[model samples]
Target: MKITLDRVNENFHFKLKNERGHIVDVDSRAEFGGSDLGASPMELVLMGVAGCSAIDMISILKKQRQEITSFRAEVEGERVQVGEAKPFKDIHIVFYLEGPINEDKAVRAAQLSFEKYCSVSKTLEPTATIHYKVVLNNKSL
Candidate 1:
């Protein structure tokens, strides 16, 4: 559960590597004197929430024998000024699932993820309010 970061340039650009050797490029926005080369740290936090929840939901569905065709999630966060830094005040996620899945199961899976399963959301729960909605086969559930 360790990672490393190396400067990619003189500015705020960096390359992050997980213990498994996976790489994620990181950088600040152009307005922050970065090269706009990769996702910012805050952006990665949102991505982490999305990815963590997606994995939980998918695992739940798979165990329930649901046939999933595709899945995608869109995450948005609102930031509030906290001293000299801006932190997320609220985070919203929209999960789009395509499959011959049961609607009730999908909804329950999402509920379980936010309320119990997703660790990333839980980590941010104390500071940020997290909300999510599920859309299954173009229908909101």
Candidate 2:
């Protein structure tokens, strides 16, 4: 997969385009002289993790014949300084699922996503610790 980045302005704002012609805007934090036009690169990394795992979990659950009404995932990351770069130290993902879904199936879907299926999480696994929790119908599973 190839991606191209073009500067949007004289500053840190840029637009990234993939081979499929999808676009994602990227910018630095305001403190770094950016205008906050879009999400920062670090934030996009977290987004990738959330998105990848969401797809995996949803696909797994669907294949298992679970009835899903709504699903949402919240991802939070803690960063640590490494030389001049602040990289994520750990990431916590909370999945909230609603519907007449089996609790164990929901939990297993999440487990499979993080432990085996999600490529984005696996890419960050060496540097960042990944943790996930599943909440099914307002109850932690």
Candidate 3:
């Protein structure tokens, strides 16, 4: 996989394109002299983790014959400032699942995604403590 980033101006505004020709705009916030055109690089990392695990959980649940009505994930991260390197200290994903899906199965699907299937989660596991919670039918489990 290849990605190229080019500066759109003299500042941090940039256009990123992948090998598949997929493109996204990336820039810093207004305080950083950027126009806030798109997501920051650090923010993108969190998005990747969320997207990857969400896909994994859905796939696993579907295979298990789960009758999911609606699914949503709320992901958040905390970045620690240490020296010149700032990295995520922790990441949390809360899954809101609705339908006839059981709490146990929903939890297991999330576990399987974070622990076994999600590449993004595995990649960040060494640097970040990944935590997850499951809520089924408007009830937190």
Candidate 4:
């Protein structure tokens, strides 16, 4: 599990490649002289948290024998204005799951992710508090 970054421009733009040779374009925000090329590093980090936990939830629910028709996550990171290092103060992840899924199972899956399964969220725990919610069939659980 290793990745490398190759500078693509004089500015903050760069190409990130994983060990599998998968590519992800990364760039700083325009305010930092980036050309709006790709996602800012912070944005990608937050996205990683979302993706990691979502995968965990899906796996957990599937093992619980729940049928999942559609699922998406909305993740938000609140960062503190620290000079040159604006780390997130907290992160909130909301999962929208549509299917014949049991509400309790859905909630439990999310809980399992935040409490034990999601590695990315656990990594950020020291620097940021993580919050989670599950919405099933348009109702918050």
Candidate 5:
């Protein structure tokens, strides 16, 4: 896929456009002259991972005939440096599943999704240590 980034100002503010023509604004604290309404590139990458895994887990659970009342994914990451060459050293995803879900099945689904299905997880595997946990109805799965 292709994406375009246009400068919004002399600072780090920019507008990003994807192949589908969707546009998003991105700016840094130094560029935006503030701390609100913008996501750093690193934050966006973590979001991508969360989104990818959430989608896959939900789909897998649904196909398995699990009654899901609620689902949430919490993603956290650690940065190793401050330059363009810097990378996220580690990432963690906590999948919370509610409503009559099987713990073993949920955990297996998450593991399979990260290991073989989620594109973002697969792509980041080479760069960072990706860890995950599954919680079903407030209990560790």
Candidate 6:
């Protein structure tokens, strides 16, 4: 997979393009770009991880005969600044599952997705510390 980034202005704003010709704009706080409109490279990486896990978890739950009422994946990253590079040293994922399914089964499904299913998590494992937790119905149970 190859992507190209083009500078949109003299500022930090840029346009990203993939090999498939899809384009997305990225910018910094100096511009009017907000989180929803633009994201930093690190934010994009976190988003990729979250999106991958969400897809995997939902698919796994569906296969497990669970009906999902609501699902949310929140990801937080801790970055280590070394000179000019800022890499994510730790990443935490909170998987929120709200439904009538068994809590244990839901947790297991999410764990499986992070450990074995999500490609993003697997790819980033060697570089970043990835941790995940499943919260069911506002309780640990």
1-141: candidate 5 lDDT, tens digit per residue: 899999876677788999998988777775437443478887889999999988888899899999999999898998787575779889988988899988888998898898889998889888799999998999986
Of 2 and 4, which scores higher on TM-score? 2
In the range 35-139, model 4's lDDT, one tens digit per residue, is 889899889989999999889999999998999999999989999988878899989888999999999999999988989988998899998999888999899
Total clashing residue pairs per candidate?
0, 0, 0, 0, 0, 0
Ranking by lDDT: 1, 2, 4, 3, 5, 6
Q: Candidate 4's error at 118, in angstroms? A: 0.7
For each candidate, what is the lDDT?
0.96, 0.95, 0.90, 0.92, 0.86, 0.85
Clashes of 1: 0
> 1-141, model 3: which lDDT tens digit per residue?
789988898878899999998989999999978899999999999899989988998898899899999989898999999899899999988989999986788999998998899999899988899988999998999
Candidate 1, clashing residue pairs? none
TM-score for each predicted model, relative to the true structure: 0.98, 0.98, 0.94, 0.96, 0.88, 0.85
Superposed Cα deviation of residue 133, candidate 4 (Å): 1.0
| Model 5: ten consecutive residues of lowest lDDT | 29-38
Model 1, CA-based lDDT: 0.96
> Which residue pairs show collisions in model 5?
none
Report the C-alpha lDDT of model 1 over 1-141, residue by residue, as the tens digit.
Answer: 999999989999999999999999999899989999999999999999999999999999999999999999999999999999999999999999999999999999999999999999999999999989999999997
lDDT of 2 by residue, 1-141 (tens): 999999999999999999999999999878989989999999999999999999999999999999899999999999999999999999999999999999989999999999998999999999999999999999998
lDDT of 6 by residue, 1-141 (tens): 899988877667789999999988787764434433478778889999999989988888898899989999889999898899988889998988888878888888878887889898888888799988889888764
